[model samples]
Target: MGQYPDAYVQYLVHFHGDRDYFECHEVMEEFWKAHPEDPRSATYVGLIQIAVGLYHSRRGNRAGAVKMLVSALAKLQPMDVRTLGLDAEELERRIRNRLADVQAENDGYTDINLPIMDPGLLHRCQTICRDKGLVWEAPSSLENDALIHKHTLRDRADVIEERARQSRLRKEQGEAR
Candidate 1:
């Protein structure tokens, strides 16, 4: 739908279809960066936190999961999220339940489906899922180790190089000053 950004729709697709929470975080973070002044900035951060929380939770990082989900809940407001076509109350309730589960030291991971209130948005996500050969609202594939442990497993050479370059630039600027 034209109502949503491509990155947001991509985020929803990865989030529910493949259950790739890491990818969800990536897409939403890009959107947030590109539109820092957008009114939905806070909501975007909350959404990214949700994905990161779920990723940590599924990886059995209870402390990390609890921290991210709590931050997400704190940052998100029902009215603010409603503007993004999500069921704000249900989303809050789900995050709270997930936080409770993480705090209680639940040993298993469960897939969470964001309560998307817009039919058009849902259809758009489903279409994208089909195109990508993924199932909509699929259960977590626990056997997929790459998806489960993406943060630790994925290559970060590019990220490392970028950080180094930024640091070098800052040093150069300071020297000039």
Candidate 2:
């Protein structure tokens, strides 16, 4: 089996363990940003979209869920992701199933596990989950407001500040022109 990165392991842990899809996107996105030239760039994006889609689905955002999941399915196609220790076929199948559910406006959230093809990778992720005091394959806690509505509930001061800074810089550049 190929070597998996620490961030990917953490992504799996948060994904299957705590059902924190937001964290799944975070860890994988950070890794993707750091390793932009990695061979798995498209795969990373597809995985991130999967997480975001699930998050939106759980939050009852049907339109958002459909958008992300559809994009994810497209990005994942025409690429072999088995090198990343994931069952590419199964992953695609699951994404399709999820997309269908979302398209039908089911309004039900289900935990989607990334099919880890490598035993070593699965073991490593499970070990990390155990160390972090999380149960593997736990279902999403529907009643957890913070988890369900993380995007709106979490602090975004830094994001807002950065956006303002960018706007100011753009305005200054326009004035110079």
lDDT (Cα atoms) of all candidates against the true structure: 0.91, 0.88
Error of 1 at 144 (Å): 1.1
Query: For residues 47-128, what per-residue lDDT tens digits would candidate 2 score against the true structure?
Result: 8999999999998888999999999888874444787788888998998999899889776678788888899888888998
How do all models score by TM-score? Answer: 0.95, 0.92
Identify the candidate with maximal lDDT: 1
Estimate candidate 2's alpha-carbon lDDT, on a 0 to 1 scale.
0.88
Clashing pairs in 2: none
Error of 2 at 98 (Å): 1.5
Off by over 4 Å in 2: 77-80
Candidate 1, which segments miss by more than 4 Å at Cα?
Answer: none
Clashing residue pairs, candidate 1?
Answer: none
lDDT of 1: 0.91
